[model samples]
Target: MKSNFITKITLCGLLLNGIYSHAQQTTLEVNTSKTITKIQPTMYGIFFEDINFAADGGLYAEMVKNRSFEFAMPFMGWSQPNSNTHSLNANSGIATPVRTSQNSNNPDFCRILINDDKGYHIINEGFRGMGIKKDAKYNLSLKAANHNNAIKKIILQLIDKDKKVLGETVITPSSTDWKDYSSQIIATATEAKAQLKITFEGTGTIDLDMISLFPEETWNNRKNGLRKDIVQLLYDLKPGFLRFPGGCIVEGRTLENRYQWKKTVGAVENRETMINRWNLEFKNRQVPDYFQSFGLGFFEYFQLSEDVGAEPLPILSCGMACQYNSGELVPINELDPYVQDALDLIEFANGAETTEWGKLRANMGHPKPFNLKYIGVGNEQWGPEYIERYKVFAAAIKSKYPNMIIVSGSGPSPDGAFFDYGMQELKKLNADIVDEHYYKNPEWFKENATRYDNYDRKGPKIFAGEYAAHPKGVEDGLKENNWLSALSESAFMTGLERNADVVHLTSYAPLMAHVDAFQWAPDMIWFDNLNSFGTANYYVQKLFSNNKGTDVLAITKDGKPLTGQNELYATAAKDVVKKELILKLVNTSGKAQDVTINLSENNVNAKGKLIILTNQNLEEYNTIAEPTKIIPTERDYKMSGKKSVLNLPAYSFTILKLKMK
Candidate 1:
């Protein structure tokens, strides 16, 4: 009876899968002559925010947690073994966290008192434990002050879960004052979850701060730099623009804590550390170790944008804190400083060497300006107060630089009274561009595919600045990042491309999240100590961004747009320089889709490339172990004259590029 029941259950599962796999065939007519508009070069881009340990523990590539001891809980990431807390028969000393200096952004440091000759160790549990590669070199650096010149030697070793040494180094501090020390270690064994153990040789007291370790080979081989693999994923996207340092972080929980671009620039040591506004946002997925080291600061952002050939779009705080939390504001009389910061940022990015801010930029490494063209005044702000402050910023920026394009905010959600009011006011003010944010479910994304079809063409341009599809049900816990949400978002992106005339720029929000230390869900990219992988949504974004055509072409079924009809969505574009016609099709139905694509008024080559990204199950997702499970698979296609018959897989995003002859 049990065997029969199991067989029946398996049969039922197969039948249900087959039912969802039924395909709905349709004809997609692409009229090359019916060009809707010119697709903006900055159409598809990336939105970066530091939430979920995206910076300190994730991308920044710093192996030491609380490097500067600047987190609200200074001793949060450090542990002293063989001490009084963990052992009763303790012969080791204690490491005391203290704030010794004032007037600096980072003032806290750990002072270890070696009570005996026995090895007293201070261990640093890296962000989810350090990812160590066998035979790979790691650079170690720290600021130390030999209090009373009592300490003789400090030993550093990288140990695995079993306390087996992977790498080791020794540092001899020869200074009584706070001084920097550096060393290198090559790992003898690979370990994904390694801890850094620092032990004092002789009984004495030593002060330490800014304890940092990084893989010797980073992206661009820069010291104290970003993770190569993660940045490589972003660079592969070929994004049109890279919006930096942001989302809610642009607006802090308090006005005093807002992201100040000037502070993020300049020398790395002088750059003050601050508490990330996203810290402690989720009680369940709490990330208390999350903080911005700013080592990958403004200069790095502009450099990354330039490296990837993406336009830099820097968003700034407009004197108002996060509305959802504190809603703190700077009185109108005190708004000049905020406005000045905006002006200074422009100078820092584009000013000449003779200018004040430009000199600082040149000193940081790049002598020539970043060639910044666009500036965003706020992120996810709302109401009359925002409009009033925006006017002041607009006036100041325009007076100094009329050609500079300034973007204003339209609140958090895509709809609501505040969003409408903000949009209406910005329209009245003749703003250059209006930024909109959206965080909705998959169905909302599918239904809103034609969101910009009715937008005012005469008003300021639209920037779909922050958007992502949340697929999980209404639960208080974090949502799953799966293929269903990604495919749904791909369907919605068709509308964004179709209305390229009004939608000047668009990017997915919360670009990356660390699996072990994250507060937000449904992120585009996920990573851990040693490895990283892009979600299905990331590949969808890459397909759109990498192939974003130069001009928009209309692809319609019958006489109307193809959106959700027969669970299919489509958009077409032409690359003038490449002399190719690009067609993107999303099949949301269960079965495969047999569609005939008619390229009207256009001639194309016989051979082309067809790329398909799909997953058998909607709930299936890409993981660190199976990073390429949902990646695109490319194949050769033979175009049948002006008409091509292509079969799109069920629940897939397909892109076809055919040469125009």
Candidate 2:
């Protein structure tokens, strides 16, 4: 009797399994012969902002903070540690900040007066301490004026938290006038939290400016370049374009603090330093020490885009401040300079060597134009004021460069009065592209997967300029770069791809953050002084970008696109150049999904590649310690005739690539 009971239970379980499998099975029909639209090369890209120490302390490869003594607090990063062994007292030396009238761009310089040779030294606490590697070389540079030939020699050393010198270099004062000095220091051991110590060997006075340090091994092995590790991650993504120097930074808290391209170009030292808008944007995460050194300026941004094989899409200010802050506006009559800035930027990027701005670009080492085709007028601005300013900018830019594509702003929110108004006005103006931003919960992303399905085809194209799925509502304080958020974004991106004609460009916002000094959460990448890692969302983006085909293919379930049907979303594209069919399926449910893709044509090869990215735990995310916690796994897949059967795991994003025979 017991055996019979066990057998009966097993049979019942099998019956239930069969029923569930039948219910979950989905058949997607792909029209391989019909090309819906030509997918834009700029469809998948990166949006870069300088927030969260992304530039000065993050990517710029500059180890020294307050390099030019130009921070609001001149000696913010410099501190004089009293040493018991050396008997260094306060009277040993005094460094006073001096402002000279000659150089307004870089007016501040430190003047050190040593009373005695009692070991007077100042240490720079590098952006939360430097990361020195064993056997690696660090290049140190500084400008010094040995006043009256008083100071004899200066010694520079890299020290750890315990003050153990890892490397040292010395420079002898050979001139009374300001002279440039550079030396290389080779470390004996690795230290993640190291500091730079500068000691004066003799008594008297010395004027110092632009004290900078960088790893000898930079991204391109160029002097004063970007962090190699960080740039390597970006290069691997194969992004189509790079939108840069943005977010709220383009529109400063006040007009005076806005990011001016003219000031950022020319010379590195002459680029004025300003307080970062994010310095005090969040009260709970205020970083008063945050500032922009502009070492990685406009030229560097363009070079980085080129190095990574991406188009440069630069966003400029529209004579208006951040609405969340001062909201100061330049009168319509006085907007000539702002409009000229846009026109001049075009010349700088695509002009000839004889042109004024192009001459500056050539002088900066890149004689060839960046071939810039897109320029954004403003960032997240709304209302009639924005439309007014945008109209003026549009007219001026069109008059000069009619073929140039202008990316106009559509406010901060994805939908509302501001977004609606901006869209209507831009359509009336026949705008080339409109930028939209979205920061919402994971559910919102999944629910809005078909947001662009009904968009006007003849109107301006969409640039999903800035977007990220906050796992929890941003206010709940539970924002994380977890698998759930990334999975939801993948699901939503299927809709973005399905409507390829409407959405031309897309990128995840807040590209990078310093793990130790970040003011924002949910960034795509995170890094510290020593290392960096891409979040789960980063892999999702990578898969889409790397596999974005040349043309879109119609993939439908029950004669309609599969978007949030039975917790599944999908899009298909054909890589004409590679002669392959690409299918992206995202299952956002907890149960495994059985999907059968039926192709209208029988040209697909039996052998294909399948890449799967999934995590049972939705909250799982990547960190510096466990960077590959949720990376993609790939394997060979076999297709039967024109039908491909796939069992997508719970909460997963799957990609199937098959060659056309």
Candidate 3:
């Protein structure tokens, strides 16, 4: 009798557990008849900044260090290592960089004086170290003013850690004045950390500036171009828009150092070098060698946008320096030149070939216009001074080009007195688009999925210009780029797509970072000398951008929007081009979720496709060693009649594509 009673109790417990599991199941209703808004093509995009050695050492493939000799501490990256560390004699050949007062912009050049024949060598440690591949060709170039033709030949060699030569080239300085010299070096072996060593043949002094080395095969095979592998990754995303030239660097430490677009165009050599705003951003990641080479300047930005089939959106400084640093504002009288810059840029982008700036653009090999449509006034500025300056810029731009859309900023944070003031003022001024930035925690992102649902529908459209969920505080210790943060962003991205009319454009900030040399943590993409890989955040971005639909459909549960109810969130869209209905679902729970989606007012095929991205651990991330660790996996999904039931795994992002009959 006791054994029978125990068996009955176990049966009862199993029955009760089954009942509770059934109760947890939910139903989602997607009404295709109720089209909320038309989705814009510029919905998902990329925000680019020069932070974290993103340009010179990260994107630009120039392997030479101190290319222009323009760093604050000239010859900071170039070093002369003694043959022996404990040598008694202090004397060896020396290379001394001299600065003249002839040019305020570029004033430094290294003067080499050879004393001992002990093979005096000056070695350049590349941004970290140059990634050299065997059987590849490298171009070595420099400007040399051989003093009285003192030096006979300069031998340039690529060496590895043990000082083994991988490649070699010889350059004979034939110019008495400053002139350019170019030679090719063919590598004999592969090395991830290679250094450029210059060996002098005779004892003499030679002035060298703009020392540069680039791969013979660059992006689009253009001379002095960007890294091919990095550009390829960007092109694969099919991004809608490309925001160029900065985050805080657009607003320099002071007005004198602010990024000037005019200085970044025309001849690459003539383009003036400027101090990067991120030079000392993080005291821990201090990089005194960081500076803008301007080789990948405005023209290159537009060219990259064109190459990726994305709209080019440029942000310019609006007469004010970085408020965080100096808060220096140009006086109203001196603001004319600032306003004139805006006008000239529009002409340079869209004007006819007969115009002055347009002629310059034509001379650079692009006769046709760049077809620029949007321009941002400032980056994360606020207060009464910003409003006053924005008013002047808006009026000037409107007077000349009324159809051009101008983007204005709403301070740094998402909420505050300054943000509120900027939004209210921009709305009153009839601003076209209002740029907002956020760098918060992952929970903040999941909770704010409906951030744009209550925005003023009739006001200026939103440009979520810069945003990323920091796993910990951005200033906190060892902030990592993990799956939890990227998954939360995927949840928030569905909301951005649902409210596409108001949220016209969005992108992740600080696009690329070098692993060894970086200031900011939690970047979207990371790279080293020869290899680059996207983070979990990058794949999330790729899924949304590549699968962005033409129109948004209403997807609700229990007659209300699904924003984290039962730890599940969802959004629906219809792709008229592909003749399919798309449903994006997120499950942020520990247990699997059983969901039955009912599609009304649309005849669907019995078979569909599902792409799911999830991992067993939330803290797991994609690194250079394993980039595809958290990528999406696709499978064929079949529907029963007009309804489809799915068992969503815990902490997963799933996308359903149902064909329409």
Candidate 4:
């Protein structure tokens, strides 16, 4: 009898344990009637920097690398190839670089002396070779002065790798004075690695400057505009704001090398070219040929923002160079010019046509104001020097434009000695918005979902600027934009949305990269000479930005936020204009979870839409060959009265949209 009783007790215990485990279901209670805060239109945006060849060789449609012969090495992109003989002395001609005193901004030009015209040709190796299409027209323009009219004609040809001409155009030099000549070449065959070959037809001397080539097709078909395909990806994001100029490029290695907005405006030819700060930034990935042509200047950035319907957020230098490099500082007394630049920029952006800077804007083809609102003082600056410079800028800007919103920096990290110090000082000054940046492992992102839960509600708002998850175990020099990084980023973004009032704006860093000439890894978008694609992280950002509702709604489990409870994170919002409720849930676990979301009010339609982004392998990522390896899939979902049962997939970010009854 005793043995029988023991067996019954053990069996009963097992039965009860199974029942209890099965009954513990994850329940989320959402308060639909109670609105937490209004989500800012600038909540989800994009941050653009010139790192990784993002500007000259990537976005700016100009194919000629050193069009004006202004690089430190004048013939950096040009090569003189001898067709008849292998000996250098047997070549048909020699080109000499000359710096003229007439033009200070663009003084360098190529003076070619053709000896016998035995196929004297110079080939320009374009930005990793120009991307050409069949039957497409390319506009070729150059400034030439035929010395003694010795060079009768300039023959231009687009040639493939085997030296076969794909397109041809001829221009006759009729004048001895500097004059503009233009012609169009139609490519007969498509080629990805084509070079521009210029052959002289006479045996005399000629000078050439501003030898530029652009695709007839561009963003909006403007003369010398941005690449159409790249711009389309940005336009599709529908970002709230577009930050311009740079990450570290704004703060050069030295103060003199810093990006000066004044030089980047005005005519394309007159704009001065400067050495890109990223030319030698990384020892492992040194791009010696990198240089800034300023073809995609401040005006083009503002124009792009307008075209994409995003608010223009321009970050300027704060009289200090990049601390990681030279750490050069302009003394307090010498800071007047920097302050004046800020004042003048506001005038250039918002002032009428009669103002000094405003007149220049009108002359650049934009008569109306850009309607600029937000301006950042610096990019990842720190310490007492930064605070000192920021104070002067804030006082001066407010004195002139009181309503303009000024974004202040909180150093180079999300949390550290410099970040803490900068945050404390900026808070004392009552800053408007404080920018914070972070690049950490995926686990760090998943753990920091509640970072701003205890933030001071009354202090300055937060701009979660420049963030990316660097997955662990990746080699030191290489980082992958894989599914794990994207999933973890989604988990952190839930917290960003939950505290909508405190976190006003956020954007991912290092927006673009080139396949063959990149200096950084894990960029949001990757492109080459011909094709471009968004990464998995980019799709996550798009999901949030597209489904970001107007007002925040409280979502909780057991009377608290569902942050990392059972590896789940969630946030809810309601769109007043669309009359829809959006619930975003992220599951970072390896097992599927059954969740029941209970609505406080019975005001949601039974039918809803669900979008899920998931991948079975965390290391799976998108490449140029497999662009859509991990993308979101949408489907219709059914609800039961005031409650909905959602089977959240493992390692997935899901968005549910329900219409208000």
Candidate 5:
């Protein structure tokens, strides 16, 4: 029955993608005897802010982006603005539908209403005065009313049955264009039904547009904001940190083009600017065109870390420009202001009351410093420009925030002298860490696991910023692996574990890419708005990251090759706080293997609890058409201990946590 069921499920499209039944694999004797796996706490991360899920704008934004928010724009008598993430601007070519005349009633957030259909409104904003209801304010224009003159101001008021003020509006004189006059309303009392009255108080007809409202509480953190549903999935992985914004988004066309810190402040629509990074056109769903007004900004990144019990490792832009797809490296002299931006950025993150940018931090509601510990200078710099700019930024920041750890991002080539040269440069600049990325073949991974053995721990530490094993891809030049990739990844992790103190932190980057909406391939977590599922690489990360311990424990296990193919990659550590021994084991063999575990030296031995992720076939994948096909499962292992042998299924990953009394 089970075989028939799998046959039916696998038949549906398994043959379509060129996947065969699980690949025939072989295993060889692997060892825990001589290998000393270091146990270092890793700051495992996903590109949560904008890389994986676009959950900004609450249900509306994520829905619209996902093409799920299906409201007819010109819904008969009902009307609403374009409501795209970006503001409706001519230069931006962004548009929305709205009602603004006597026959047209604006439902606050629905649209801006102009007196009986005769003008326009533009959203004008700054930091302090933009609040949803409490601090929100707006304007109206009648410029299109033929003989109507430009109004100096407009007194907007909302009244209930007894005539109590429920909302208020005001206009400004800066009218080169039809500008927006807006403010949040703090009704003396609550009233569901209210009437809006625009007291022109000036020589002109009145016009109004869309007005948006949000409780002050909901708008607090915008960028790194994860929907509860998405957060729940992420929380399950138990990651230690998050990499915000994105690798390419950090370096914009111009300084102003760069993410503006000031635009993402406060508790209202006015204070935020929406600049999202993903554009889903399949369903007319567009995101990244608008920044959620960045309602959730940098300050929120810190808060999110606290919320998820993770640490914050913020990176600064190096002066060197980024070629999103061109893959060209800019020369050094061309990158200057960008370097300074890096310096001042740190001032904003960790400076005190005495500094200018720090005062902005204080004004943003976090008076005390964010205490940002890890500050990466540049991201994936491929040219000499990145190297030089990194030095300048490193000097300035280290001079100011001496205690901060400066991380360096090296390009993909291991043979590239840049890493060696970059490492040598760090010694002079007193760099705290070096970022090494790996996007390679399973065999290369097997060869590269010990790549850091020659690395000097006495020197700056290291971080595996972006890495994955794929079937021969362009970026990593990784060759293909049939069933052995999972085990190869597990093998690489063994080295990371054995060298934890020196490894300091590690994260698998470009963590996710929506399959059809992908800019990059073979992401750690892949999904669309409707559904999401992690990849095999993600499982490897989850297995290793979730079972981390505060200190390394000496462990020993002996086993022969479970199969003729490369097999059995494993790591072990003792959890200091829980008094438990956790072992991460992976079997690349296509068949089950019996393994003997000896834990007599660690003292109190108890039955082991296992959380496993196994697929009947190795080629199983998640797609937009069917998203839940391949997900990890958790099961309890029946036995353990010295001379005790147990069976491990093939092409699978297992994380075993054994408790000690």
Candidate 6:
């Protein structure tokens, strides 16, 4: 009897232990063997608040073929070509005539002779071993130095190696005063063929401003004209679509400064009025004509989307309500002009000959109606006042362009009419998409990734327009600009992929900013005048966005928050292209965790590749001085029996891609 009692007590203890384990159990079962999600092939894109992909604080836009600041002009000896008044201190180009060879006192032509190496200008240059061919079709532009020398017409010429003219196009100068000029040509390329000399073939000593060449392949949606390098980089991201000309900079005084799509068309150098809201911090915030010369305009955005193999997501300012600090919202009675702007924008994008905008679009070259399927009504607009404004635009736009998808933007506030009334308005108006912004710490990211997992997928889908960890307070021993949220972003992205069906599309906001630009925190891409690079977050995003899959495998895990410290995460993706399983693991622990992967049940035999982002010191960062301090690195892997074991470093994020045979 005693022996029997002892056995029963032991059994009970074991049973209790089993019960506890069950209570703390967590399992992820991928119903299918592998899931694939298709991501826009380009891992990068720009948030374009400024020139090229230089956000001065945002994402990557490879628009500028060669980047240089207005200040750096003199350093490069770009003396603005004309006038004694030219001074970098004044931030003014040579506004006067530069040609001294003429007998006339008023040699009002701006010219930069490439006759000497030191005398060359950035206008005709490119980076990464790319530049205009001496025989390539080209265009010439000049800021007419003086009204007296105003060109009646100008000829664009391309020359070959033997100084033989190969191509020329004569274009009549349109402006009475200094304005940009462009004319195209057809030419073939050859080695040693150099120099494009524009003889004031016109009656006047052509006051030259600037001239450039265009390759057959051009990207649209460029600001301050377009930066080829930046555009090329953006094209690399392979975005499915793009929403343009905004973020906090949507507000403009009157319609002229506003992104009036009409004025931004035609030859790029001629588009007038290039002003950035960021430059407003300086006194007298007069936006000197930096030449919006919108060579790449709204129409170009559409073309670029097509060229980059992505869809077009165009955004227009809603009719009535104005942006905060953008002056007061126009009342309902007086919103007619803004409303018409939105309408005209759509017509310009999708209309055919019958409409003037459409005709202009065709005249610019593309005769086919651009595929403008998505149209956002205002950016980050919220509140009942905003609701009234959104409703007005929504009703008008949907009525006019019925097939277009509408996206609404709002901050991540649970309160305010922006959320309550915005959703209510969407429900009332049958809105198609809702956009939300998030910036938080990595810890916050882990919890928030799961936050929307249970969101209502049947209703309006979500667009995580902009999100990243905005870790504010200074941490112990961390550098002032240390990027601590990269690992967190990766973990969150894994969650995003798991729910891609509900999350149709997402992009990090304030995408492109210059390193000198600091308007907002947590910018994803950074650049200087000459060189550009992406942040840690930028690389993580590149990896994931470039390798998305179509199906999702349910995740089954046998681990709980390890060691009472909830700082471990891992994910796997099946390589559709290479036929492999990819897994990413993050162990943010002070001590390492021995990670073992087992797939014997699913016949999950595989090989692995592990890439890591690790910094010995949490406060470590890559300054301009040392850029590779904390970048991702690849390592060899060994997989065992039913399990693959991994020893993860502290505070490290690892991605493992498994190739299943």
Among these predictions, the greatest lDDT belongs to 2
Which segments of model 2 are wrong by more than 4 Å?
Answer: 1-23, 83-88, 473-479
Candidate 4 residue-wise lDDT, 1-661, digit = tens: 0011001111244753543443325999999999999999999999999988899989998999999999999999998877346856565788889998898889899999899786788899999999989999999999999989999889999999999999999999988999999999999998888999999888899999999888999988988889998888888777999998977899899999998898898888889999999999989889899999999998899999999889999999999999999999999999999989889988888889999999988989999999999999989999999999999999999999999999999989898899999999999999999999999999999999999999999899999989999988774322379999999999999999999999999999889999888888788999888888888898999889889999999999999998899999999999999999999999998877778999999999999888888897998988888887888877778899999988777798999999997
Please give, for residues 279-350, the per-residue lDDT of candidate 5 as tens digits: 332234343333344535666666665555666676666754454543444456665666666666677777
Candidate 5, lDDT over the whole model: 0.51
Local accuracy by lDDT, each model: 0.86, 0.91, 0.85, 0.90, 0.51, 0.53
lDDT at position 175, candidate 1:
88
lDDT of 6: 0.53
What CA root-mean-square deviation does each model show from the true structure?
A: 5.9, 6.6, 7.5, 8.6, 11.4, 12.5
| Window of ten residues with lowest summed lDDT in model 5 | 1-10
Model 1 per-residue lDDT tens digits across residues 1-661 = 0000001111244753565455556888888866679999899999999988888888888998888777788888888878875586375788888886663767778888888857679889998899999999999999999978888888999998888888899999888999999999999988888999998877788899889899998988989888998888888888889998998899998888889888887767667888787777767876566778788788899998998789999999999999998999988899999999999999999999999999988998889999999999989889988999999999999999899999889999898898889998999999999999999989999999999899999999999999988875734212367888899999999999999999999999889988777788888989988888888888899889888899999888997889889889999999999998999999888888788888786488989988888887988888888877778777777887788987777898989999988
Q: In candidate 2, which residue pairs get closer than 3 Å at backbone N, Cα or C atoms, i.e. clash?
A: none
- Candidate 3 lDDT for residue 34: 67
lDDT tens per residue, model 2, 1-661: 0000001111244753663474478899999999999999999999999999999999899999999999999999998765324554757887888989889999999999888666679999999999989999999999999988888889999999888999999998878999999999999999889999999878899999999999999997998899999998898788999998987999999999999998889899899998999999999899999999898889999999999999999999999999999999999999999999999999999999999999999999999999999999999999999999999999999898999999999999999999999999999999999999999999999999999999999999999999999876433222399899999999999999999999999999889999889888889999989998888899999899989999999999899999999999999999989998999999999988899899998999999988888899998888888887888878778899999888887889999999998
Over all chains combined, what TM-score does candidate 6 have?
Answer: 0.69
Compared to the true structure, candidate 3 yields what TM-score? Answer: 0.93
**TM-score for candidate 5:** 0.66
Q: Give the lowest summed-lDDT range of ten residues in model 1.
A: 1-10
For all candidates, what are the clash counts? 4, 0, 0, 0, 52, 62
